[model samples]
Target: MSNPPVCRRCGEPVVASAEQYEVFERMHYVCFHYEFEHQGDPDVECPAGGCPAAGITLPSLLFRTEGLDLAQAGNTVVPAILALEKLGFAVEHHDDGFAATARGSRFVAEDPVALLGLIKLVETRRPWRATDAEIDDALGRYDL
Candidate 1:
């Protein structure tokens, strides 16, 4: 048999059906999102429909959690950290602050829609009080 189609952007096998290959222009979803949709400053919220940074005031929160100093991050830091932990994107380390979970880092790097969903949940709900079931439901809406 012939080889599978390759991603134009990353030069890897597309690993999709013929229809999906055509639809995605022979690129992985992540590569397409990065090459076409994710542009300009990474810290700036992406305007693409499912981008986590969309309309958020603190997009940098997604990337710079480790060793974060509450004193430097200001009052919202606590809420943001709480929200991230509630979403399973971050884990608290007591006196050391928070670190991104493996899943969270993968989402930040590859899945804009999932990232958007997490941010939306934190923005709309009180993460400090949100139940695990509620968080699961919110993420489910994004098919994560």
Candidate 2:
């Protein structure tokens, strides 16, 4: 068997440019990407041309796609936030909105799940924001 050879969204010719591409089953599309697992290069941009998914690093993709953002920190926060946003959680800052960091923003765009998650987590654990450990524990309790 061989890979299907075009952009499912635009019907454009797909190139073997990135290390891999993702299959957006909901959208019935296969998008090219530069993820770490199947990634070939870090410097190359995704071939989709202005695709939001292209902005996410491979780790982010895996994090969100796998639903693993319950408890995290550092670089994980960004991806976890992105994952939540992708899931329709409605993100916004405490005062602003669900925009990823400048670099993350470029990719995460208007995802709100992260913000929603943050708010919910804050409310549930008031007087104590979550640490990676707490999050992991909570996620585990829920079987994530």
Writing each residue's lDDT as its tens digit, candidate 2 over 1-144 gives 565455555566555532333444212233333322224454434444443445345553454457544544455656766665565554445444444333233223333444445444543464656789989999989976
Cα deviation in Å at residue 87, candidate 2? 0.6
Error of 1 at 84 (Å): 15
What TM-score would you give candidate 2 relative to the actual structure?
Answer: 0.21
> Top model by lDDT, which number?
1
- Model 1, 1-144: lDDT tens digits are 788888898888876544588676678776777777899875466657656454455545444454765443355555655656676664434343334464535223223333434556555666436589977998988876
Count of clashes in candidate 1:
1
RMSD in angstroms, all models?
17.0, 14.0
Which sections of candidate 1 miss by over 4 Å?
Answer: 16-19, 42-45, 52-144
**Whole-model lDDT values for every prediction:** 0.59, 0.47
